[model samples]
Target: VVDLEAIADQSYQFVEWTGDNGTIADTTANATTITMNGSYTIRAEFDITTYTLDISSTAVGNVIEPGEGSFEYDDGTMVNLEAVADEGYHFVEWTGDNGTIGDLTANETTVEMLNDYTITAEFEINTYSLTVDSTAGGNVIEPGEGTFEYDDGTMVNLEAAADEGYHFVEWTGDNGTIGDVTANETTVEMLNDYTITAEFEINTYTLDISSTEGGSVVAPGEGSFEYEHGTTVDLEAVADTGYHFVEWTGDNGTIGDVTANETTVEIFEDYTITAEIEEMAAEYYQLTVEVEGNGTVDIDPDQNEYEEGTEVTLTAIPDADWNFGEWTGDHKGEDAEINVTMDEDKNITAVFEEEPTDEYELTIAIEGNGTTEPGEGTHTYENGTAVTVEATPADGWQFSEWTGDVPEGQENETEITITMDMDKVVTANFEEEDTTLFDVGITNYDEEVVKGENVTIEYTVHNPTDKVVTEDIILIIDGERVVVQEDVTLEPGQEVTLEYQWEAEDAGEFTISTDDEDDPDPVTVTVEEEDDGMDMMLIGGIVAVIVIILALIGYMMMKGGEGSETEMEEETEEMEELETDEEEETDEEELDEEDETMEEGSDEEEMEEETEEEEMVDEDIEEEL
Candidate 1:
């Protein structure tokens, strides 16, 4: 048997042995045995080892050359790497170790592999652009008016400056890009490519105010003034002595009150206004006074002539049993005393009449569902006076007659005349008509309602007889006709539902019924005030606050109790410490007493021993003798 072996050096690998003359057991194995049947020769093969190269890239990009995945290359081999990025993306750098990159920033680069290497081509998103512009009256000051570049989510400071006579309004752009649209100086987040504009407006207007020779402008004073557009400016003109202000005339802009010396003007465009004034002329006019009836007229200053624009006071005095009625002629009024302007010739008359000596009372009364003229009350009238009374009946009722002190022939008339020779009482009577053609009954209605809400009353009207009947169905509230369904026709034995809506304007009890006499029962509704939720909420809030306060007090009381307990515990501990100290002192005293007693006992024992020794010495002496 012959043994075969193949050995490989460092960084090299062994391959299968190759030979033609021997019977090898395994030719592919590194160590094997061969039978030596004949003379044979074998050779070992080796090869250089190759390392794995892994190439990859980040998202949105990929390696184009020597593409992705594992690749085997010999040592010291240089591999070209190229990274292609998608739109809106760019190559950033190359990452990973075990390899030498030619250029980290360059998209197309090379990597030399010395061992197993993992190379990653890094990619980054591109930066966006921002373009800013302005209107005619403004200019962007920050990052000055041109296109700017920024990364995503970059907040850029923006500022707009307005020219003279102008004001910055706002910054307008794509929605949600600007931090504050109404501020002149604000910021914008660059989310994407964006275009924004700064808006401004020319707002000021000039107002030139002047006045005629007799007057001068006082308010917003006479010279030229500048005001913002749509500004209301007050204008006042004061006339010199003996001069009168006429009217205000303006070439442009709206004057609130043009005829008044003090007014306001709304400025839109440039405006020029003048306050016209005229000199007052002095003239005198004659005052003529006339008296009618039994009144005497007296004029202040008692002058027959007065200057123009002078106010004269006139007093009217009547004789006994007479009263001043009114004034007539140039000035007409019912005032007993009056002031008249003497601009021209003035003539005024004071008329008076004697008071009536005999006056009577007329009392009016109503019967049934009707109202009378002058109402139901007592009215005063002169003696032998005639009073006319008219009666108007409610729905389903007619005026029947006039009774009580009415003229005999006029008793049957709706309108009657009553002579008030003395204290008299008259009555206007109304009677219900036979207009009930249907058997009406309330079917549905609400008995309780809220104020300011609507209430619906539904009633059914049926024709009970074998005939077609047409009648008016009226809704009455508190004996007054509120609404009427006119000319409702129903066939025999037919029924229909009629509905009436009434707004409950006030909180009260109201009775609702139909005018049909067949409807005997009236539905009464009680309107209640609407419940206020705010009141309940306020009460609940107050209760909650009170409960919170009570809880706080209880907590404080609990804390106080804990503090008291702690104090008591501290006092108990102090007392226990005092007791321990006293016990220690007592033990020390007992030890001192024990030591003194032992010293005394020892002294006694020593004295006895000395006595025994002396006795023994004496005995010895005797024996020696």
Candidate 2:
């Protein structure tokens, strides 16, 4: 025998046995047994039953059922049942192929698969025929689907007119009904659709083993659904009368109440109970789900900002016939006391515990997946570092490339610097050789100053090219441009700081502008009154003169008039010299003040700049110091 216990439907076994008398005989013996599905064969016979039995035997049965997988649908395949015979007592009469209706022959019955096909012994069915019809259209219907609206509080009269001689019998439905019901008539009183069903009472039947009720068993009717397992799924049982239930006995004894039996089982154990007239199953709604995070949330409508740190509470309401479903995500839903994941970058979903819940498509990304509001931001990562990207445009501008010395492969939203070192300018039409500079800070000669002292303007210029800037840059101030005319060689990209001084003149407002508008702008400045320090000195000298005068008076009183006249002449000469020195100082202060307010307003502009070169130099200085 073949060991087929471990195999599924695609396997089988063949075995053989022999008899005594030293004569090799066929496999069939005086007593042999065969079984199929779960029952033993109804009849059996031996090949040779005379005198001494032969010993030789073969495992293959003379007449054997073919293996599965041969029969199919559409471009059809079939199983050929052959009864093998050696020298035998005449082969008996039997149907080889056509086992049921559409059967033609007694010895060889050929099977032609119609819409559906099944194999059965003609000995089983006597001569009965099954006729199916529906009160609504299409007697062959789906579960929990398809129906027509009828007046409420009235029984939906469904006429399942049986075959010619058959009479109406039992009725069934998905949601079992209750009311006055008999074999033919049914009364419905409640709501809910069902897999409405009805059987028939037939006579002159050849067989009772089977009926042509072989389509899909409708589950629920229009507006209805299947119930959860193990729960007492309530039904509007009082809707339709004469509504019965069809019980299915599975291979495994798992239905209602069964004793301990060690047997294997199939998919479902229970069966569908139905009502005669169905009122579609009803679904409940107003399903509410409440959720809360582990932080606080402040909703800013104008900015669309959600500030979360502690916890938040959210209430969700569903459409009619929907109820709050189990929650999915970091937290399980109960009373909404969910301890959210420390980093839940997505919104948790709450669903209805009903059939066919809706679905949505969401985008998932590891970086640059969120928005940074006007004032709010969230930091996320890619390759273990932070990055941010924006979908909206910045208020007054758009984002342009900042191309700086950044690490390679850095993508959008990575924080990097934009170079503002130099500006693009007109490249030709100059008296000197063509040149270029990199990250150079232009000079601004016009600045506010005080006229009482010499005013100094300092700027750093650079030749960032291989050529030299031979043009003497005339530093213009108040319309008086001063040309350096100094001959100098500036190496490639060489930088130099220049400082210029102007002597004091008449006091007046003067506009100090850059001599070259084609260059960068200049700085605006104020020149206040100069601090000459002469007032304090003059005051001190007057005090000294008073003291000297008093001292001379005292000396005259003590020594009479000796040398008094000589002292007076000396004092007069000293006073004259003091006056002359004071005049010169006053003139210098006045001239410096006048120089500051020169009143000439050339095209004045103020420029401010910060340089990376300055920073690099500072770094070098620190290293040196």
> Highest lDDT among the candidates is held by which one?
1
lDDT of 1 by residue, 519-598 (tens): 57888999998666433433443354345335444644565655566655654464455445434444543453334224
- Model 2 spans with C-alpha error above 4 angstroms: 1-449, 464-466, 504-506, 536-540, 561-625
| lDDT of each residue in 1-625, candidate 2, tens digit only | 1111211121212233432312323333433433333422232221311121111112222433342223443312333433332331222333333443243323233443332343322221112112223443223231122454432233454344455444555565542453433445444433443445555543231100111132212322223233322323222212222222233332223333222111111222233332223333322222122333222222222122233322344444445554455556544664423443212233455554333323321121222222222113222222223222223333323333223232345333324322222221111111222222322333554445565646666666666667765444455556675654244457677877777666545455554444464546645445566555534544554454455445545645665555568865764565455445445544644453355443323101100111232233345334423
Q: How many clashes (backbone atoms < 3 Å, residues ≥3 apart in a chain or on different chains) does model 2 have?
A: 54
| Residue 60, model 1: Cα distance from true site in angstroms | 11
lDDT of 2 at 389: 28
User: Against the true structure, whose TM-score is highest?
Assistant: 1
How close to the true structure is residue 507 of candidate 1, measured as C-alpha lDDT?
94
**CA lDDT, every model vs. true structure:** 0.79, 0.36
TM-score of each: 0.37, 0.22
Q: Write down the lDDT that model 1 would get.
A: 0.79
